[model samples]
Target chain A: MRAIVWKSATVLILIYVAVMGFLGPVPEREILYETIRNLYFHVPMWFTMTAMFITSLVYSIKYLNTKQESYDVWAVEFANGGILFGFLGLTTGMIWAQFTWGAWWSFDPKQNGAAVTLLIYLAYMVLRNSITDSKSRAKVSAVYNIYAFAAMVPLIFILPRLTDSLHPGAEGNPAFSGYDLDGTMRLVFYPAVIGWIMLGVWIVSLRVRIRNIKDKMYESSL
Target chain B: MKAAYSALAFIALPLFTLAAKYEPVTWDKTFRESGKIFVVVAVVLLILLSVFGYLITQDRRISKIEKELKNK
Candidate 1:
């Protein structure tokens, strides 16, 4: 019964967002119009990525404190989900950039920074694979996860500010202020973000459950 | 160590945001069309790569465990 309510609530929220997004009043200008549509997907992707990264970081810290393999597994699963969402965010951002900036990719600090952040996480995974001892792997990977998360800050935030970007809200660029979004648009945008974030958590939970099940099977076999 | 890394990353966000300046450029028609194609292809490739990578990782882990069990 609780599951039914939760499912129905999610469905209703999605429906509301869809209707508001499509029907909301937006500028008739082609660029603005198209970019507006991107808000529904692009912003949500970022939110989801942020959520997963935070989850990964939390588990990484927990593993470091407890020295438990389960925490390490949770961290890895969350990081995997984070990377998936990050890639989706990058793709969506690139699509928006192409239409708005007339380029597939720009060395814009933000763009390059995001790519570097992804690489750092990839390196963490590779490091995990290269290690053989279970305890050693967990310890080293947890350490790497912490480092990767730390590196993400400069890549995502610092480098972007030192240079110019085609993306909105850059230092010199005129960004969309609160006034830029009408109440109607906000109605859809905020809900979309929440819904997408919820979806991200759902994915992470499912992955963690699968990992736990697999671990159980492996242990039984042993 | 992971906490240190996370702290550094988080700290960099504000600085990066401060350094970034946004500049709007006029996009040409050809650029817009080609950009769309590029984005679509990139997205598809990313999805494919992720799926393939996951499968390979799963296969490698399963085989490694199987080998270990057999040896035992």
Candidate 2:
């Protein structure tokens, strides 16, 4: 019953955001114009991704302490979901930038920082695959996951705020809040963030379940 | 016929309220200015649908594998 409600809520919220995001009224700023609607989709991807990465970091730390294989599986799956969200965020950002910033890859500080953060997480995955032994693999990857997440936090959240970034709410740019003072967009924006984070977690949970099943099968075979 | 138009009015009511919340000129320039935006909307819809479909199938496959393992 709880699961049904969760699933229904996730679906309903996403549908509402999708419909309302497109039709929603936005402040017609000079450059953003209609493209500001990308806020609902693009910005939330990063927020969702960041939350997933944080979950990965927690699970990684838990795995180190408890030495539980399930914890490692949870960590890896959350990272996988985060990486997927990162890619979606990057693509949508590029599309938005192409229209607003007049180029696909502008090498802005925020853009560069985002790319590096994604690379750090990608390296964590590659590190996981290098080891053959399951126990060692889990241990090494968990440590690396901790380090990668530490680096990612600074790269995405801190560095962007420190530099003059083309992205909004950066050193040189004003945030969406300045113009969107009416807060109508917040209606859909908050829902979009919640919906995306819920969906990302759902995906990570499914992946972890599959990994657990695979581990069981392997153990039985042995 | 009367009910249908009223239904339309009910739906459009919120949207109009949305428009009125912001300046008319700004709304006109952003939303009404571009028909091409619907193309972008179409693309986004397609991507979202495909993503949801993939997740559903992957979920089903995982559930099937888990069931098989359980029976064994």
Candidate 3:
């Protein structure tokens, strides 16, 4: 019954998002109507990436507190999900950029910074694999996860603020204001974010369950 | 840990609210330029994600091998 309710809620939310996105408002004298559609895909990717990282950080702290293998598994799974969304976000953003910028790539601060942030997380996973001892693996990986997330702050937040960039919300860039967004756009945009986040959670939940099942099978065989 | 959570909430809430307030300008020259940057970054990000996924699978394999050795 609970599962049905959750599924229905997700369906209804998706429907709402689709309607808003397709029939959303467009300001007069705009240049890229088709490019506007990227919002549904691009913005949600960032939301999912942020949510996944938070989940990973929480589980890392939990592992530190309890030293439990389960917590470590949860952290890794969430981290994996984070990287997936981060990549998707970057891809969609690139598609939008190509049509608008007339080039495939730019040395924008946000672009370079996010790339480095993704690499940090990748390095964390690599560090985990190189260790042979279970306890040592969890301990060192947890420590690295903590540090990587901390490093993300400067890359995503600080550096973007310091330099000029083609991306919005940078220094000297016009900040987003309420007047810029219409009520109709809000209708789709908000729900898109919520739906993507829920989907990310669902993915992480499945990964965690798979990890649990594999562990159980291995233990039984032993 | 609590501090970190609070800080994230503080930063994200305002930014989200601000993002909600404005409609993203579409079809502008600058918007298109930004979009191009987004694509290039995304491709690089995809490659990075694949690498991470590979590393994770390797970690699982190593863990399995270690467990097997202990059992033996």
**Candidate number with greatest lDDT:** 2
In candidate 2 the C-alpha lDDT for residue A86 amounts to 96
Residue lDDT tens for model 3, A8-48: 46555755565455445544324455555556668888878
Candidate 2 lDDT, B10-69, residue by residue in tens:
999889887775744453554444656667667777887777778778877888988998
How well does chain B match by TM-score in each candidate? 0.52, 0.55, 0.52
Best by TM-score: 2
lDDT over C-alpha atoms for residue A108 of model 2 = 86
Candidate 1 regions exceeding 4 Å error are A1-8, A27-30, A172-176, B1-72
- Least accurate 10 contiguous residues by lDDT in model 1 chain A: A172-181
> Which pairs of residues collide in candidate 2?
none
Query: After superposing candidate 2, which stretches have Cα over 4 Å from the reference?
Result: A171-176, B1-50
DockQ values of all predictions? 0.03, 0.28, 0.05
C-alpha lDDT of residue B40 in model 3: 48
Flag the better candidate by DockQ, 1 or 3.
3
